[model samples]
Target: MSIPFGHQQLHNRYCFEGKLELVTALRISSGRASDETDAPFIRAFDGAPYIPGSSLRGAIRSEVERVLASMGKEVGLISCTLFEKDACAEKARKFLQKIETEKVKKDAGSNKQKNELTAEFAKLELCDVCKLLGSTVYASRLVIEDALPVDVAIARNHIRIRDGVGIDRDTGSAKDGAKFDYEVIDPINSSITFLFKMTAENVTDDSDRKLINLILGLLKHGLHVGGKRTGGLGKIKLKETDNAFYKVSGFENSTSLWKAIVNGEKIHNSIEWQEVIKC
Candidate 1:
């Protein structure tokens, strides 16, 4: 992943590694049913329910957008929800066209210089949220790994059933033949904990760093994932103890960062590497 700004190669890596406890039942579905049930929870190939990285990324992106839409508006942190027609990116393209036209007229700058200028302008056009969580125009700054139960045996035993019925709005009654049941894990209360790890690249900007800290704060305070959020399922929080954010900076090139990434080394807690920072 790049720094959510441009497609430049990443030279640095920062990792947030920890355990996340399931405070409530989770019911993210596989969208297919087994012979014994109308719905089933999503599971890894090992037959244990695992939360996909894509799902976690989507949820965090939504939360980041929500925060940016509220806190970033005053500072020009635009939120473009439009698909491919995001206005800011479009405007940037148009502006780049003008710059290209002017450059051609002046016969100024080498091809490399022109390309660098275009990239800078494009980067400037991105909003803070787009710069942090990413949009259609750019790749995200970080990646999350799929969350799996630390103790698979415990997870296997936690599957539970929940019955749901569709209601008719007009009659305020249960719709005929609309009752269904689905599978959930550790529905009421849970002792289930999953591994949580996120890796971000080339986050040097203060605003980008602050956004990263804010995301951690949100996770620390807790956030709900999976389905049935309105019904209070999928409430998860970072385990405060032993959680760590590693700012593995001071590297000179991508080679060292790649080595650090592969090793998954946990550095000591110091003035630099704090455990969990407030937003």
Candidate 2:
């Protein structure tokens, strides 16, 4: 099948390695518990506090959507409930249908055909967010790894309980039996790191890259994560330590991609890709 998107004809994948510092206590609650603390932070298999990739992805996507909306651009995939009423949603649905129809015709009982269909789907003409983060019709080009604490021992020391109470509107005071406690990651003593990867297939344009960079810029400005934002929780600052951008069309081996990242060469200055910070 032919590519239905714009000028781009090859895949361009970019990888970002970064660290997240908690400026304030972050409380990504795992929900209520029977223990002393009513809420607790989410933990990994090893019983250590961790930030899920999905959480980060959702946060970034939401912020980018807001930015796009401010520019009078509708990039987010809207819900079906609003499809008929929203112009953006209608456009997205039509685009998805076109890809789905073509994919069905090209679908054969072979891995090659499946891969080709996936590639074609990724190249569809859709909103920037849907193109990068994906929607129902396309697979996500962006992959975010779980952010693990750099030092587990140090991370443990940062965990603390914060007490809270609900207030009665009429009395303007704490409501009776409304006291609660939740666990939080204290920023005073800890920091975490994570990895980000983006695969831009058949990208002949710079709009998506510019948008991704804008999202990263927003992330650096302290994006709130988790819950209780009104109560001053989950404020974080993300810093990118290393990044690599590659044109993967003519590569002889896939292992070279990892090698480029490992080499740590500063290639963010290139015009072909967006400029990313090194520190």
* lDDT of every predicted structure (CA atoms): 0.70, 0.60
lDDT of 1 by residue, 189-268 (tens): 45788888787777645566666776787787778888887788888887766344223333434666566567875332
**Best candidate according to lDDT:** 1
Backbone clashes in model 1:
0
lDDT of 2 by residue, 1-279 (tens): 232453233334455555676777777877658476778888887878887877878777777776665552343232122233644346656755765676688764365654555456445444666666766655666667777777776776788888878678899999999887888888784464433333344333455546666666776787877777657777767664555222222221235445556787442322244444222
- For model 2, the local distance difference test gives 0.60
Question: After superposition, which runs of candidate 2 have C-alpha atoms over 4 Å from their true positions?
Answer: 1-10, 32-34, 72-84, 87-125, 166-176, 189-204, 240-273, 276-279
lDDT score, residue 245, model 2? 23
Cα shift from native, residue 217, model 2 (Å): 1.1
Which pairs of residues collide in candidate 2? 8-204, 10-202
- Which runs in model 1 stand beyond 4 Å of their true positions? 1-5, 73-122, 166-174, 187-189, 243-271, 274-279
TM-score of each: 0.73, 0.66
Alpha-carbon shift of residue 136 in model 2 (angstroms): 2.6
